[model samples]
Target: MIVLKNPHLSVHIDEMQGAELRGIYTPDARNALASYEWSSPTPVGRGASYGSSEMDWLSGYRGGWQETIPNAGQNCVVDGVELGFHGDASRTRWSIVDQGADWCTLETSTRLPIRVRRTMRLDPDRAVMYIEGHVVNESDLEIVFLWGHHPAFPSVDGGRIDLPDGCTIHPDVNRSGDLLTQDSPWPMAKTSSGEFADLSEQPALGSHRLLYVTGNKVGWSAVRQPDPYVSVAMSWDVAKHPYVWLWTMRQTPEYPWYGRASMFALEAQSAWPYDGLAGAKQRGQGIKIKPRGEESSWMTLAIIPNGSGTVTGVTKNGEVTFKSSEMH
Candidate 1:
């Protein structure tokens, strides 16, 4: 575990696990992101075989933050190479290229002819973490791939998800059978029967939903948890990440949850349709990297203690300002 700390916040990165962010802690030692201790053994890569990626991914998931690269969801074959569940980066060990008191850079070479690099820098005077990263295609052939961030936050009963003004929401699966089959504008979704359901408001326990939100005027999202009076916010480049994948689950009775977890993930993505790289190719979506080309972006995360109110925007420096001073 590589730890980076400033006066106000601390970050944990697991070097053996894709350099995955294990946690972000406030002054009170509370982690803004979700972390869990599952009953099963830790998950590890078992080579790229059919149905193995999903099993390994869920078995080893510990709920911090992961970078799903080359592929986002499910296991699929790309260019005759099997890309694991979230790609090889999430499970591959990363070599630390450089480090400082408040920042570190790690690099890894994946199964495909690509190299991934990520740098995490903690603000010295604020509760903000800055992440800058890029993927380089080493092969002579161009590569079309899906790149995204997966950060999970604990879900409170009355929590709310805040996005920019002009966004729309579409669910991957309507297991709840309430959300509309089509896209609806932010904070409001039409049910199959034509009634309105509040997409911003977190649902009750035993409920789970995976939604894809797009058409955002800007690239930012904040999840406010009222009970703890803390808000976890993320801001990124809209061009690099055009979509936000919202995954919410409360004590889901399934293989991974088993009625023991409640959390939501706000992911910044470069492509659409969670069917992995193959799906993205079928839909003509995702980033296309030229031979030996590189793609990079930056992300900012802030932990606000009294930021449960409506957040107007989050700056690149990690400052959170509400709509009014009263909300503070």
Candidate 2:
């Protein structure tokens, strides 16, 4: 376990399991991250081999935050090249390149001629974490890949979700009941049962709702908790990562879920579903990387304190505003 610290927050990362963020804590809370209550023992050391995969990665799945490169969904084969879920980047061990009192940088390179470098920094007085990273294409050929961040946080029933202007729901990203292929504006959508289900709030028990957001001119998503009164607000570059996938899994009784765990994930990705590079190419959203090409973006997340309210907007300095309350 590698730990990065500051005055108000401490971020714990697990190097043994794909360098996932095991926990993100504040002074008031030990673990602000969402976790699964598995009856099974937590797996130690490295995970399964990429070749022996067909949706078995969740056998040892520990919910947290991880980076996905070139892929972000089920394992598949494209153009004779095999790709695994969320790709090998999250599964591979990352080495610490630099460290200091308030910040640390970790680096990893994948087999796809792409190298990723992520730097995490903390504010000394604020409850926030700043992330900066980039991908470099080492080969002469352009690489089409899905780059994103997956953070699973503790979501409560009735919590609210806020998105940017003109944001629309993506039907392909797994919806509950009969809302699978329906296209509707975010926050509120009519269910197949002729009832209006608020897509913005966390559903009741026994729900596995997945909502993806696209067509937004800006980049930001905030999950507001009504009980604890603290909300997590994330902001990034919409031009680079234009899509946001919001997933809530609760009481799923299938193989991996096993009717356990209650968590929500907010993903900021360059593209959609993890069908490998070919899938992005087919959607006409493939990024063309020239030889020695490099692309970069930054993200900021804050654990705002002391209020249960809706997030109206984020400032240029990364401070989230709760419309019902003041920033103090």
Which candidate tops TM-score? 1
Candidate 1 error regions (>4 Å)? 41-51, 173-177, 192-195, 325-328
Error of 2 at 39 (Å): 6.4
lDDT of 2: 0.74
Task: Estimate, for each residue in 84-104, the C-alpha lDDT of model 1 and write its tens digit.
Answer: 888778888899999998999
Off by over 4 Å in 2: 37-54, 173-175, 178-180, 273-276, 306-308, 324-328
- Model 2 Cα lDDT, one tens digit per residue, 1-328: 7888877888888765667888888776657678654655333234544334534456557688988776676665654677777777887788888888778888888757888888888878888888888789998877777778889877676677778767778655445544556678886766667877777877777777766787877788887776564567888877778888777887778656777677888888877654545677788764566778998888888886535466777653568866665444
Colliding residue pairs in candidate 2: none
TM-score, structure 1 vs. true: 0.93
Give the Cα error of residue 50 in candidate 2, in Å. 11
lDDT of 1: 0.82
